[model samples]
Target chain A: MGDFLETDEKVLISLCKRGDLSAYDRLMQRYEKKVYALCFRMVGNQDDAADLAQEAFLKAFRALSSFNGQAQFSTWLYRIVTNTCLDEQRRQARRPQLLSLDKPLNTEDGQLLLTLPAEASDPLDTALSQETEAEIKTLLSMLPASQRIVLVLRDMEGYSYEEIAQILNINGGTVKSRLNRARARLRDLYLKKEELFRPTVHLNRKERRDRL
Target chain B: MSCEKFTKNMGAYLDCVLSGKELSEFQEHLSVCNTCRQEAEELQSMFSWLKQAGELTPPKDLRKSVLAELKKEQGRKGIRSFPGFSYAAPAAVVLIMLVVGNLSLLLPLHVSDAVPMRAAYQQESGTVTPPADAIIYTEDSPDNEQVSEKSELSSEVERNPSPRLLVLNLVLIPLFLFFSLRFQQNRKEAG
Candidate 1:
């Protein structure tokens, strides 16, 4: 048992494949915290994240025979955890989006401002720095799953673009574009929640013209 | 560059993927464009906050729960992988090898090393080896008669290899099919 702690990940995986339960436990211990944290960010909760992490681990164990070592083990495990959360998200009814990132938002200043949901009464009432992680997490949950995942991976988890591409099974260009879009959306969400909910009304091009 | 076009390149500019002339074009646009510059800075600050934010601490029991779940799965996997097909397939192989091994023991069949194959038998399965260090095949033990019979059979095969080989094949084919079918059934149940 102590020897397993000293073993590398590859040897531990091989031992796991050969039905060494202790080896798998060692591997689980190495990754459980990371997986749980990822799941929490994806699912936006603690209990559900724990359950999702466990489910992902079980699924990975069952599919162990198919896990060729082409990608790193952590990468493969992250893929499973991300997929598990996405699948769970699909099972539940999603909240309707108040603002669509796809819309071409034109402000009075002629700039396309991708602002947060107007439903927030006065989010910026408090100082931006006073904004809590809990608020950001909530705001993140409101973003589309596709965009949310990219933002979480690139911004919060700090995975490189290439690593995210491999984990998401997308190409590098797709990763960049998705990450850009995700950051844009998250910025809008966070700003709307923490800084944009202020005294000024951002009139669209048509609204300004009408007023003029 | 047009702001419309710059919109597409905004990500690249922020990512620093733009270079040389392309980079100059983006910077020149941002230098003149208040909106785009302000947007970039806001996006930059927001993302920096995300990056710098401390990771949430995972629940303390997360490891324990995952391990508990895995242990339960391991038990079920053990059950499904053992008995029935898995056990039968190997047992059948050992049975055929036992015939060949026992035949070689006395008569020297085509694949020799019969002599009751205690060592090979031990390797094939623990079926023959009793739990604990109990004596096996002692002079008065009931296992002795079966051991003697295997040796007698081996001598017969040593005298006649061709006929014995044909008979072993006949016994092997049906046993193979039977074990394989049962193994599939076990797999289906497990699945």
Candidate 2:
């Protein structure tokens, strides 16, 4: 399976370099979702994720000549995505803005404008699980950008420490320390929100059993 | 292992990167230490929750939009790689600077009268006189016509410097410095 994927990637890359837009399109189709997922988790916002993911692909295409094939194409693509996200975060830091949490922030005449659905309305959103996810995202955002990137790449994306170090252009020791600090901070946050992380259904089941 | 030592190595231990003697020693500490055991359990649960959060599927339009953007970029690249296109921006900037510099030099000045007055004052006071090559065009000078031409050129440059050139120098110098520093920083970071 690995050999097949590597071969397919090599063929697509050759075609892409030759200005084959269709081949590039096929390559994007293959990895767009994964790239978007990584961006979404890193930035913690859907719109920014989409924008950053698109930028990463665009940058990858422009810099395709420099892709020396030292690493897997996906790894190189991910490094671009990570750098793009970090740059965006740095730009945003220079000009911070306050965001309102309330959805459907306004109404125009009789119609709703900018109506964003609350997590409660999401189909996949169980209350406890959604709360846990939201809390985790909040905690992740609290981390410094360097530590947050390493944590997301390591724990969430399951990239090896070496891969992450390579992606960030840092050494393994720095990666280890950053990941450890991020994990410790997150663990501390989770401890505070332990109630939200508890198994709600199991608790309900036990309560019902006791009542019966 | 001491509690402090265990705490320091807890992350590596949880990642299962510690091996053999250290791993065994950590396990023994966990077995005997209630506080460390609880800490380990909490760290394990937190990691589990993180994994469960999982990857999300991007919006359906993402692929189409990305391809569209890439096509637009490719079109731009096509235009940019055309012959002489790459040098256009730098060439334009240099051309502007040269034109502005020459224009500033050629502009008329109000300093023609002051030159002789300064020269006379310097000679009478036995102070540092103007450069011997700089012909001070006075009413009594032998080469009055030649001195007038040289004086006109020097006076224009010394007295009536173009505001546009001044503004360009002010802006471009700082911009050049800023970009130089930024490039150095980027190189440092890249390395």
Interface RMSD (Å), every candidate: 4.3, 3.6
Q: How would you encode candidate 1's per-residue C-alpha lDDT over B18-72 as one tens digit per residue?
A: 8999889889999999988988998888877776444555667766776677677
Minimal lDDT window, size 10, model 2 chain A: A102-111
- Indicate the DockQ of the complex predicted as candidate 1: 0.21
Task: Give me the candidate number with maximum TM-score.
Answer: 2
**Proportion of true inter-chain contacts also present in candidate 1:** 0.48
Model 2 bad stretches (over 4 Å): A97-128, A194-212, B87-191
TM-score of 2: 0.65
- Residue A179, candidate 2: how far off, in angstroms? 1.2
Off by over 4 Å in 1: A1-7, A94-131, A195-212, B83-191
TM-score of each: 0.59, 0.65
Whole-model lDDT values for every prediction: 0.70, 0.72
TM-score of chain A of each: 0.71, 0.78
Q: Give the per-residue lDDT digits (tens) of candidate 2, residues A61-98.
A: 76787888988788888889889999998997788554
